[model samples]
Target: MRDQDVEPFFATLQAANPSPETELEYTSVFELLAAVLLSAQATDAGVNKATRRLFPVAGTPQAILDLGLERLEESIRTIGLYRTKARNLLATCRILVDQHGGEVPRTRDALEALPGVGRKTANVVLNVAFGEATMAVDTHIFRVSNRTGLAPGKDPLEVEHKLLERVPAKYLHDAHHWLILHGRYVCVARLPQCWRCAVRAYCDYEPKTPPPGDRAG
Candidate 1:
């Protein structure tokens, strides 16, 4: 999309939902980290289903360590790659407790040092938990960025940098959330629901799909 349209595009999204948030449920920074770590290749709804049961019992780093590996695996078994995620979470908790006094770190370097916490996961934690203007370019965000012509790039890191450079400062902090939500519900991988999209006017996608009733038989 043109630089001129960027502001209005975000403005439209902000007007539709002023306070967008991550779909993953969490009440604390640590819990948020855990949820994001477990969310790889899994749906937010699925992670929520498992975390709803796990967090209550072992919400803290120490408590999660105390829960032990076997039980931790059992708690999140419903999610894909449970064994690997469980190991990573436990290792991360160990680092949090042993190195950071059981508190989630604030810096990108520190956050990514933990197992299962890559650049994208670190970005999400930094943005959602610490109010940083970092973009966690997930599948949804990646698709939306390229599809909308907002910040197209060959890779997520490239897209992230493009977004950081292109997005206005006022919308930088929450831009990822808006894009993710739009991609998830409207500008999906399949035929985009452009007919009802609020920001369809600003999007660069061509030959916008018509509503079912309007499609040619």
Candidate 2:
């Protein structure tokens, strides 16, 4: 995409939703980081459902440590990879308590050092928690980026780097939210809802999904 296209793309997205935010439900950065970690291979609704109860009782690192791995696992066992996620979350909380004064770290290195916190998870935490301009390339963003020619790349890291360079400064902060929402609702994996897409005009995708019952209108 061109420089001009970058600005207009974000303009349309921003116009549709003036204040976009991550769907992951959390009251604090620690909660947000924990939520993102558990969200891997899981849906927002699933993560929210699990965290709603967990956060109230044990959101902080010390609190989570108190909850213990067994209880934590039971809380989020409803979601996939719950066992692994529980272990990672517990370990991460321990690290945060011992190393970072029980606070969620702002730097990527610090965040990534936590168990289960990968590049994508760190990016999400950094962007949402710290207002950093980082892109978390999930399946939805990966598909949308390549399909729309927004920042086409074979891998998530490649797409993330390209997006960092190409995405305009004005849109950098909210790019993750906008793209995730768009990919989740409009530019879907199976059948894109082209009719409802707000940025369809700027999208460079060929053979766009036809409107329902169009009869070649």
Residues 1-217 of candidate 1 have per-residue lDDT tens digits of 9999999999999999999999999999999999999999999999999999999999999999999999999999999999999999999999999999999999999999999999999999999999999999999999999998999999999999999999999998999999999999999998999999999999999999999999999
Relative to the true structure, candidate 1 reaches a TM of 0.98
lDDT (tens digit, per residue) of candidate 2 on 150-209 = 999999999999999889888899998899999999999998888778888888886778
TM-score of 2: 0.96
Give all candidates' CA lDDT scores: 0.96, 0.91
Model 2, position 159, has a per-residue lDDT of 97
- The runs of at least 3 residues in candidate 2 whose Cα sits more than 4 Å from the true structure, single-residue gaps closed, are 215-217
Candidate 1: where is the Cα deviation over 4 Å? none
Q: What TM-score, over all chains together, does every model reach? A: 0.98, 0.96
For residue 55, give model 2's deviation from the true position in Å. 0.9
